[model samples]
Target chain A: MQRYKCIVAYDGTGFAGYQVQPGKRTVQLEIEQALSKIHKGDSVRIAASGRTDAGVHARGQVVHFDSKLQIPGERFKKALNAMLPRDISILDASPVDMDFHARFTSVRKEYRYRISLSEERDPFLRDYAYHYPYPLNLEAMKEAAQYLKGTHDFTSFCSAKTEVVDKVRTVEEIIFNTSDDELVIQFIGNGFLYNMVRIMTGTLLEVGSGKKAPAEMETILAARDRIQAGKTAPGHGLYLWKVDYA
Target chain B: MQRYKCIVAYDGTGFAGYQVQPGKRTVQLEIEQALSKIHKGDSVRIAASGRTDAGVHARGQVVHFDSKLQIPGERFKKALNAMLPRDISILDASPVDMDFHARFTSVRKEYRYRISLSEERDPFLRDYAYHYPYPLNLEAMKEAAQYLKGTHDFTSFCSAKTEVVDKVRTVEEIIFNTSDDELVIQFIGNGFLYNMVRIMTGTLLEVGSGKKAPAEMETILAARDRIQAGKTAPGHGLYLWKVDYA
Candidate 1:
């Protein structure tokens, strides 16, 4: 048996999410189905670096699978891409050591959220960005983002649906960038909890819109309660930008 | 009665084309349908700057329509946008002089063709760019593009299906730009014939790939025959970037 690692990119528009759920279309199910076909009816399971919510796109999602097939590593990319739908593509594929775990070995992950401030909706970017017609105070948002950069208990930013007790995580960097009509926020961290990034984004947006003060981010973090943070931003605006492993 | 000029944008993935057919989903049909909805069953027609082929996107397509609805120009934009499908959007709308015509009054039009030379297909840009997975000489393509600029009889570059006899058209500019993995070619001209831009892109790509010499563009133009040109590029890679009227 041989283990293979691959970097994947997907549009995520039509996918239920990254995980496999019975009767639901998902990125994992599609990739497994394609892999099963290659394995001649044998089931193939893949482990991903992380799970993305529905409508969340990925630019460099990493995954690993063990297989007995003797085909070359480069050929797997071509074969899998040919079978995969247009929205999902395997960017790179290579054999990895048997001990390499896609999820456990990841050192850092980066996510980007795009918010379009254009008064008019952009037809092309409708699926890619969250369109917020209201004016936002960029300086206020940047000030709030600074508070989020560092190790903290992110329970207030996490989804209540998760049962994970260890809500502490280290956010290494928070980058805020602006163009003419869009605000891009990038988060680099050791890991993110369920809906953590989206909830954080919502909180920053509220600060930017004057609904909440920049200092409120610290209060929300200190509360360690989900209700203390703002609402979860829509998943369509979120992208798993990149993942790092060592 | 009022004449309204609007700048429209569309993904064009699900659209048959810009023109309305008996039983087809088209940009014009969708706009007219939305207008008719606003007019309470009174049929409405819109004249576009030009027709785009099926699968061709648009960023700044100009159109004019006569309406009896006594709504303000800004309100018209909102109402029309609400009625139109997600794929199409009215970027801007305003009342125009009754004498203004979308097609006849147009002085220049710009079309963009994107060619992705990356070996891996980009899932995000799958619908917007053509994945040509081949080495291309960018310098050769730019040199060939220069030969096609300016006033010329472009019979060899036009589609054979076109019935328009006067093939003499002035190409104002040809801009060749490159990023890390994509080549963007923009053609600005007074007008384009049926599939003219696609043919020009294909011919230039041929020059870039070393399949045809850069100097051959001049010979192909002088031939005045459609058979002398390269294959027509796919319509999906084309975009009606902008239209200007004076």
Candidate 2:
């Protein structure tokens, strides 16, 4: 059996989430089903870099799977894309060393959150962007985001229901970009807990809107309580932008 | 009666077309239904700048309707948006003079067609762009497009089943803009016949791909037969960008 590593991209609008559910559609389920079809009904399991919540898109999601097929390795991308739905695409696929683990071996991950600043909702972007019509104080947001960088226990920034007990993680950097009617927030970190980026975005937005002070982020972090942070941003506005391997 | 002029936008991936067919969902039908609801069961009709085929999107489609309701003009936008589906949006709405007409008074229109040159299909843009990976000769396309500008009876470039008697129209400009892996073809004309922009794009693409010579465009125009042109480009790649009135 040969181990294969593939880069996948998916529009998360039609999916329940990244992982497989009992009866719901998901990106992993679709890929595994396509692999099963190629393997002549033999079920094959694949592992991804991580799981994304519902309505979270991926631009460069990494996955690995083991398969025994007679076809050449280069033909895998085409075969899988042809069988998969249009919302999911196998961007690149190739044989990988057996030691390559898509999840455990990942060094860092980058996520992007989009907030639309248009007073009028854009029909084309409604499903993709979080529409926030109110004007935000960019300086305040920047000041608040600075408090989130570096190492800390992100208990207050993650979902209270997150089963992971060890919430300590290093946030490498937080970047902000603004265009005509959109504000993009990028979070680069060693790892993120469930809903960490969304909670951070919501907290920063609150600071920008004067609901929370920029210095309040420090207090929220020190509290180490879920209720200390602001509301969680919607999943539709978040994208798994890229993953890096060491 | 108050005449209302509104600029509308829609993602055409869901609807059958712009016009109201018997049972198929359409942009016009959705707007009319929203208006009917606002008018308390009195069916209201709307006249648009023109009709678009199935899977054709619009960003600045202009429409006018007569209403006897007592609501202020500014609230009309909010009310219609509240009732219409998420795919459609009323961008701007206002009271217009009695002499203003949506269809008859239009002086110019701008339409954009997107052609994606990426070898790997982007899952995010699959519904909005035409994935054409092959390289094209831009100079040849520009030369062919030059022949199509100004006044001409665009019989060969329109659908053969078009029932319009006068096929003459003035094509003011055909602009090409390329960035990264996408090519945007913008058509600015006084008016366009059925399938005119799509057919013209297909013919120009043929010229660009070396399938047809740049000089063949003049001959195709002289023939005045729809069969003389190349195949019609898909409707999904086309967007009605803007409309202007005198």
| Cα interface RMSD of each candidate | 0.8, 0.7
Each candidate's fnat, listed in order, reads 0.84, 0.76
TM-score of chain B of 2: 0.99
Chain A TM-score from candidate 1: 0.98
Docking class of 1: high
Residue B128 in candidate 2 has what lDDT?
94
Best by the TM-score measure? 2
| Docking quality (DockQ) for each candidate | 0.83, 0.85
Model 1 chain A worst lDDT run, 10 consecutive residues: A65-74
Docking class of 2: high
| Deviation in Å, model 2, residue A27 alpha carbon | 0.4
Model 2 CA lDDT for position B115: 94
Residue-level lDDT for A200 in candidate 2 = 97
- Separate clash counts for every candidate: 0, 0
Q: Which pairs clash (backbone N, Cα, C closer than 3 Å) in model 2?
A: none
TM-score of each: 0.97, 0.98
Model 2, range A1-246, lDDT digits (tens) per residue? Answer: 899999999999999999999999999999999999999999999999999989999999999999987555569999999899999988899998899999999999999999999988899998899999998999999999889999999999989888998999999989999999999999999999999999999999899899999999999999999899999999999999899999
